[model samples]
Target: MQKILCFTALFASLVLTFLNTQSEAAIGANEIIRFSWRANTEPVTGYKLYYAEGAVTGPPFNGKNALQGNSPINVGNVTQTSLSGLDVHQNYSFALTAFNECSESAFTDVIIVYSVTISIHGNGTVGTYTSFWTENHGNETIHFFPSDGHFVSNVVVNGTSFGSTESITLNDVTEKKVIDVYFSPEKTVERDTSFPLWSGSFNENADVQGSIFIASDGVYVSQTTDTYTTNISKVSDGFCPKSGWNANYHLIQFIDVDNDGWLDIAGFGYNGLVVAYGIDGTNYHTAVNVISGNFGYNNGWRIDHHIREISDIDGDGVNDVWGFGYNGLVVAYGIDGTNYHKPKLALNSFGYNDGWEITDYRRFLDVDNDGYLDISGWKDGVNYVSLFNSANETYDNIVEWW
Candidate 1:
C-alpha cells in the first residue's frame, strides 16, 4: 500500500509541471485585456497581464521595449479581478493568462477604447452688440440658445440651456453705455458660480461692440472712441489717459468746463494743473492753463488730487467740479465765468471719512420738478449711486431716484 501511494504522488507532480508550462505558452499577440479577470475551471486563482507598444509575441517583455515598465507584473492571488494604470489614449496590445496551484489559461480577445472632442462658436451679429446668445453642439441643432436683454433670463445647466422672461431695456442712453449680461443657473449647481458671462457696450456714437470680461463683478461700460482700452478694474477711479499723455497727468473729466454751452474738456494732470480746452465747434483749442498751480500731490505730507466727480454741485447754473484726495478729503470747486474756485473741501466736525470713496458727482435736476438741487456720486464697491440732499446737507441711501 505504501509503494502504491508514492507512485501516485509522483505522477500528480509531473502533470502539474506540464500544465504550468502549457499555460505560459498559450498567450498570443492580441488579447482583450482587463486589469483583472475571473478564474475559469482548473482551480485557477490569479492572473498575469502583459502589454507592449507594438505587436510582439513571447516572454521576457521587459526593458524600454515594454511600454509600461521593466518588470513583468505578477497579479498575485486575486480571487476575481485586478487593477492597472495604463494610458487610455494610446493603441496598446495586451494579453491575460489565468493562474492557479496547478495550471493557467490562454489570453482573450483584443478590444479598444478611444476619446471625443467638441467645438463652440457665436452666430448672428459679429460686431453689432446684442444680448442674444447661441451655442452650437456637435449636432446641427442649437443646444444652448437665449434671447437678448437681461442676463437673468439666460440659464444653463450641465451643458443644458433654459430661458426665462426677466429682461431689461437699455435706458439712460448716452455716448457710451455698458450692457451687462449675467447667467443665473439653477440651485442644484452653485450660486457664486453664476456670473457675467457676456457683455456689450456702445461707443462714442452708440456703435455696438462685444465687451471683454471685467472682474466678474457684472459691471461694464463703453469707452469713448478716443479713449484707450483700459482694464475694467480701474474704470471707476475715473477716466485714465486714453492716448497721448503721461501717468500723473491723466484725463480726469471730459465736459464743458468753461460753460460755453458746448462740451469743453477739463483734466487735472501732473504738476497740479486743472487744464481746460475749448471745443471750437470743430477742434480743441490748445489747452489753456485753468487751475494749473492749485491741485495734485503735495510734498509727501499729503496730496490733494483733483475730484473725479465733475458736475454742477452748487446749482448756480454753472457746472462745478468735485474730487476726493488723500486723507479722506472731498473738494468742490465752482467754475466762475472766468476761472474755478480754489477747491473747497466738504467739512464735518469729525472730518470727511464717512465711508464715501467718491468717483464722480452730479447735480440731480428735480426730474419730478422739485425745487431743491439734488447731489449724487458714483461710489466705490456699491452698484447703486449715492444721493445727497444738498438743501439739508444730508446724505440718503436712495435707489429709486438713481
Candidate 2:
C-alpha cells in the first residue's frame, strides 16, 4: 500500500523579545495599523471598512457615535487605509465590503483580535510574555507545560482537568491577573496498544475549522463548504520543521483517547519532550511537559519518527501503536489494552534490506485480504508488504511487487 506521512523547539525567544519590547500598555492612544488587501470586481466604486470593538454581534450599532467612537468605526473610498484612534488593549472586529452607486456587497467574514498577555509558572515556560504586555490578546489560549518526568495535574486557570484549554476572549478577564498552574507525577504505565489512538476533533468541526491533513513538511487544514475548518494558532516548538523526522517530533498529533469529545494534541522531539495538549474537552490545552516521561527516544527506547498510529493487531481487545522511521526500521509498543506486554524492535526490514529500503512511506492495510491489517510500502521501485502476526504481534512475510 502507498503511504502518506508528513509532519520544533527553538522554544521561545523572538516572541519573548517582542513581548518584552513594551511592558506598559500603550493605553489611551491612537495606534496606526496599515491595511492592504486584494481589489474588488469591476463596476466597484470603492471599498468600505467596518470595524467594531469586541465582537460584532449585528448591525444597527449606535450610528450616532459610529463615525468616531472606538466602536463601529467606518471608513470609505480607498483600496487600503490606516486605522487610527484604535483603543489600546481592546479586541476589535473588522469587515470589508465593496460599494457602488447601485448597491453594497455583503460584509465579509468578521475578523477579530483581542488584547492579551500570557505568563507561565513553575519550571516550565508558556508563550512570549509573563504579564502586562501590549499584545492584541483576543482569544487568549495558552498550553501549560511542566518540567521533565511529569504529567500536568492539578492545573488551574487554563481550566479543569490536566492541561485544560480555556478561551481568554470568553473568559473575559478585563484586568491583568496572575494565573496559577501546576503539574503532577503521571501514573501512565506504557502498555501495548493501551494508549488510545490519536484522533482529531470528534463531532466534526467541533475542534477544528476544517479537516486536517499533512503534506511535505507541514500539517495543514482545508476548508470545505460542507463544514467549517479549525483555526490553527501557533503550535509549540516554533515554526515549521527544518530537517527530516527530527522535526517530526514537533508534529502535534491529535487524539481523544478518553472519547470525551475534546481532542488532545501530542508533540514529540524524541530526545526532548513528548507533550500532550488539552486532556479534557475543556476548549483548552496546555504545554504539558512530556512529564509522563514515557514512549520517547530520550527517556526510553527510541522509535516513532515520521509516523505513528494506534490499532488492534489481533482479535485481542488490547491496542498497539507502531512507528515507522528510516531504513525500514519499525518500533512497536505492545500494550494489551491496559498493560505493557511485548515491547521491542518490531521490524528491521521487510527482508530485502540488502537492496531495497523503506523511506518515510508506510500504511497498514490488509493487502492479502486476510482480515488482518498489514504494513505496506514501496521499496526498490516496487511494493513491499507485510502482515501482522497475531501470535507474536509482529509483522511478517516479505513480498515484492511485480
Candidate 3:
C-alpha cells in the first residue's frame, strides 16, 4: 500500500514596495518595483511570481499573464526579489505562491503597483488647474486660454506639435508624458476678396434673384429689370395685422416652418411673435402666435434680441426656435408640427448685460462635431464655446483664435 502524506505551505502575507534608492544599472532605462513577503511556515521548494498590467478583480492567477516579462518568474526560495524592466506608466497587479514537490499553495492576496506622474508646463490650465496625476487609461481634456494680447503659438506634446486647436483630449493615457504650450503676440492679417464683386438687375435670373423688404403695413418682394426699374408685390400681412406688431421695431425671416418643402414667414415684433406657413410669394395663412402673451421689452425679450434661424439645437432632426436676449438670457422652444413646444431655458444668464451682439459675432453650431449645437462666439481677443452649462461665466472653454 502507498502512503498519502499531506503537507501545507501557508504564507502569512505578501507586500509590494517601491525601491527609492535602487539603481537601474542592469535594466537600461526601465524601472523597478521591489516585492517582499513572509516565507511560508512549512518547508517549500521555491516561490513563483505572477502579475498582470491592470487591476485583477479576483484571481486564480496564471503565470503567462505578466505584462513586463514572463510570469511565474522563478525567484528560487528567496523571500524578496526586485522586478526590473517595468514601465512606470503601467499599473501592475501581482500575486505570490509557494510550490513543493507534491502541490503548490493558493495565491496570496493581490498587490497593486500602480501610479504615474503627469507633468504639465504651459501658460493656461486644464480641469480646474489641479490634478497632476491620473490613473492608467484615464481621460483628460486640456483647454488653452492665452492671456490678453497673446495667442497660443503651438502646443507641444512629448516634443511633437499638436496643431493650433483650442482644446484636446488625452484618451486612454498609458505613458509618462510632457505637455508644453507656447504663446505668441496676436497679429492681424489683411487680405483682399477672393471673388470679384459686381451689381446687376435682380430679374436677370427670375428664379435666383429676388429681394424681400418690410413696410409698416405688410411685407413685400421686389425684382429689378435691366434698366434699373424696380417692381414690388405684397407678400403677406402676417406682420401688420399681427397682434402686438411694432411698426418701427420688428423683424421677419423666411423659414420652412412645417417641413412642407415650401418657404414660410417668421415674424418677430415689439411685443409678440408669429410663424405663418403657406407663403407662396403672394399670400399666406393668418399669423398664429407662437408664444401666448407679449414678451415685454423690459422683461426678457426685446427688439434688439438676437432671433436666430430655425436649427436643430437639440439634435432632434426637427428645427427649433432660438432667441438670445441682450442680457445674456437664452430661450429655446422645440417644434411639434407647426407649433412650438414648451420653452426650455438653455442658459439663464451668461454674460448678462454685457452688450453681446449675436448677429455680429455669436453663432450656434456644433463646434466640436458632437451632434448637439453649442453656443459659440468671439469677443475682444478670444473665441469661446459654451460646451457645457454656461451659467454666468463666459470664460469656459475659451481659446485664442487669431
Worst 10 residues of 2 by lDDT: 8-17
lDDT of 2 by residue, 41-129 (tens): 44455666666666554553322223244433445654566555554445555666666666666666555444443333435445323
| Residue range with the least summed lDDT across 10 consecutive positions in model 1 | 11-20
Model 1 residue pairs with clashes? 31-109, 32-109, 32-110, 36-82, 249-269, 249-270, 256-264, 307-323, 309-360, 309-361
Off by over 4 Å in 1: 1-245, 279-281, 292-294, 299-307, 327-329, 335-337, 349-355, 358-370, 374-402
lDDT of each: 0.35, 0.43, 0.54
TM-score of each: 0.30, 0.35, 0.40
Tell me which of candidates 1 and 2 scores higher on TM-score: 2
Q: lDDT score, residue 263, model 2?
A: 50
User: Which regions in candidate 3 have their CA more than 4 angstroms from the true location?
Assistant: 1-210, 222-232, 241-244, 294-299, 305-308, 326-329, 349-355, 358-360, 388-402
Q: How close to the true structure is residue 199 of candidate 3, measured as C-alpha lDDT?
A: 28
| Residue 388 displacement in candidate 3 (angstroms) | 4.9
Per-candidate clash tally:
10, 33, 0
Cα lDDT tens digits, model 3, 1-402, are: 444334654555887665423211122233556778988887777888887765674464443423345776878898998776655445567888887778778878777554332333334433322122223435656566666765554456666454344556776544445566654445332211221111221222222234444454555443322211134444565465333455345555666666654556676655445777743333457777775443333235655545445656665667776666654534445567476765545664333365566444767767767565677777775676666433552223434444
Worst 10 residues of 3 by lDDT: 189-198
Task: Name the best candidate (by lDDT).
Answer: 3
